[model samples]
Target: MNFRRLFAVMLKEMRQMRRDRITLAMIVGIPVMQLVLFGYAINLNLRGLSAGIADQAGTAGARALVMDMVATGVIAPTQTVNTPQELMASLRRGEISVGVVIPPDFERRRIDGREAVQVLVDGSDTVVQSAAVQLAQMPLDNSVALANATGAREVTARQIAVVSFYNPERRSAVNIVPGLIGVILTMTMVLFTGVSIVRERERGNMELLIATPVSRSELMIGKVLPYVGIGLVQTTLVLLLGLWLFKVPVRGSVLDVYVAALLLIVANLTLGLMISTKAQSQFQAMQMSFFVFLPSILLSGFMFPFAGMPRVIQWLAEVLPLTHFLRLIRGVMLRGAGLPELWPDVAALIAFTAVMMTLAISRFRKRLD
Candidate 1:
């Protein structure tokens, strides 16, 4: 209970903390990162969801209805299609979230109280689904009045028909299970590889490794190859559990899912190896992995709708491997999208793997110094 010794110990510990610059930076950086992501980036109240319009009516009424849907601030029309089939194709390719189909008989149908507009929604995302439902229920008296061919007519009936594609049942598992694969792989692969080199250095294995004939690039690849198999195993377990427990459907080819998972696993492993190359200790490696993990989870469209994020945030999110993987997995599992529909995301993952592997190899030195 000597205050003098206790204060001296506290001061010594403070000095030690100050010397660990990475830890010090993380202490300040992690909280600020969380604040910025949650406060500005993670928005649940979604708006400006990309939409496509297939206006077969080719009339003023159809155009007016499109404008009305845009004015709701729920959806923004980004593409014009000749048929609803094209709209669905765009949805499968992850190009748009909502689709507005105005039939050629729009004026006649509205007057006769028949369904005038078919609003097709990509229901794999619940936030977008909720917004589409709201748009369907909105009272568009002005648009309906202006759209009438003869004159302004008031129809006291619902005109928009909302059709939810993919997950018509609106099951959360349908959306979550696919995304869970990416999230789990990101966490495990990154963490496992993040500590590999650091652990070797700590356990006195670096000297033996350096004495071997293996080149730095060879060493890095060797370190990552085993983890790739481990990642694939983990992905299989998660998919099996999701199917058995949640009844999550895999609509696309199972091989496609594995292909996407493989790309993600390699990309994340390379990213972790790159982190390990820079980190001085396993503790620092873990901290850095968490740093990458938080953004991957929050900004990667796993927890929030990608369309809802601010434009700049969306751009930043595009750089994360998880963002693209989620799209690939969800597009495959939920939307039944094929490689033709998901080539862009596949390319992104490949590019990420290349960049990360280059960086990791470049950063690792053969010597312990």
Candidate 2:
């Protein structure tokens, strides 16, 4: 309660705090880092989504409609494909989120006050779908009304057919549940595996393993095989629960889902092995695991729409294994997407796993040194 003593103790604590540079930097730096990251990364404005237009009309009104869509700032005109098939192909490749197919008679109809345009949106993204629908409709009503007002005779207004494929209802669970599988796997698989080799080193067992004849690659694989099976079981349980509890539809082959799941698990596990090598103790391993886990959660499109983020943040999110896996799982579970449709994500996971395994094996040494 003494003021003098309180000041003395405060000064002493301040000195000690200054000496603990890591903790001091963490206190000031971590908050600033997160604030900058979250501030710039979080965006609700779904603007400039890549779009392809199939303007069969090739006329003035049809061109006006496409320009109006771009003016809405929802769908950016990225490609001008000649056929609906080409537009759909771009959608399937995930190249474009919005596809506008102007019918052959679109301009004639708009002139005659009976315009009908087909707008196909990739509904895999709930937020983008909603935004696209809103912006798409905003311009549509004006165009429709204008068509009616400008017509020679009393005629019907333009009609925009907004079709949201993959998730027509815009149900959140249909999008989140599949991504949850990746999130859960990333959390558990990374933390548990992160501690695995570190615990051995801390407990004086790594020395014995080093004395044995096993090579590093062999040792790494041996450690990972058991976790692979565990990963499969965990994936199955989480997926079943999602299906039962959320009625989350599995649109693609169940086998394909698990196949991708297995590959994703291996990728995460390999990254954990790399973390385990640098961590000197179990606590350090856990800290490192979370350091990796935190980014995967926020930036992986697990919680928010990926396209809603700035382009740079989207590229950073691409670095995380969870991002690709979430894409693959969501595509398979919600869109019935096959391997051909999802090969890029599959390839990303494969490349990531290979790189992490190489790093872990290189860093791993059996000796305490």
Candidate 3:
């Protein structure tokens, strides 16, 4: 073996790695972080759903029925409205997932040998809604038992019904694919952009480019555009695979998905640029990108339902760009929601891109200060 040459190469490699310590740490840290975070974070099962009650009966028996429903632990009644219209309005506002209404004749119907009760659910979230509806069925089951006990003719009461709005099929793919678009785009954009910039810096060529008349903003834009193209390609690949292989239906306009992809691609590239700006070496940039990505996949409602997470974790998820991106794509693709419906997500993505790009530029312009 050429020991001298090998030693020289080894020394140079060590120097490069040492300068890019953050990348090294990210490389070591991200995999472990993902393993731990995903293990703990992705929970498909739901608990503690926010429910609304419309108790027009306002009687002791009616209150008792609502209490029985609450005891199931799958749902918690957050408010009581006086009418069904109020409950529906609350659902539109996302104040509650399930709405239960007990008519004024609730108690009288039981006494008069009749049955009347109903449950309304948004059903946008299949897993959680089903769990809420299962709990809401408690009152009807109780009525059945009471009627059997009273020796009355079995009354097949049909007033109680379960309504599922957005994804009535409860298709897992429908719920998952919208969020996956964001996750994959973010990961690909960040990885490619972050690592590519670091490679340029590490190769000692970045100084030459900086010495040129190319302004920092122009240089940054130049560095980001190629990765943006790559991200769009990846987005297209994923969408095609998802549609053809997974057979997940595309319910919304194709333009919506494309628009969402473009925004997310830019945001993720900005995030990657931010990581690269913070990192002195290519490997370090990769590490930070992976670290950011793990929590994104786990907490961004991609693999798990956000409602199932603890309140603190949900709050944590709110800061992540992927969280908002997922909401936008899911709303468009699954619910056929329009810009008015997904405006918050678009606004959040825009803000995140602006902030991340500013940070990245500021850091990149700082001369090792």
> Who wins the TM-score comparison?
1
Error of 1 at 123 (Å): 0.5
Error of 1 at 355 (Å): 0.6
- CA RMSD per model (angstroms): 1.4, 3.6, 4.7
Scored by CA lDDT, what does every candidate get? 0.90, 0.81, 0.74
Over the stretch 1-369, how does candidate 2's per-residue lDDT look in tens digits? 899999999999999878765456567766776796678887777888888889898765567667777887888888998898887777766778889898897756656555467788888788878887764346444455555666633223236767888888888888888888898889988887788898897788888898999999999988888888888998899888988998888988899899988988999999999988887778768767767876788888888777778888899899899999987887777767776788989899999999999999999977777
Give every collision pair in model 1: none
What value of lDDT does candidate 2 attain over all alpha carbons?
Answer: 0.81
lDDT of 3 by residue, 1-369 (tens): 999999999999988877766756765776777775667666667877888898988876567666667777777889888899888766654557788888888856766655456777766667776786675345445545555676643334344556676667777776777677787888778887787667776777777776788877777778788877777787788788888876766666778878888888998888888888777677567667767887888888777778788787888888888888777676666656654556777888899999988887777762422
The reply for model 2, stretches above 4 Å from the true place, is 1-29, 140-158
Off by over 4 Å in 1: 147-153
RMSD of 3: 4.7
**Which candidate number maximizes lDDT?**
1
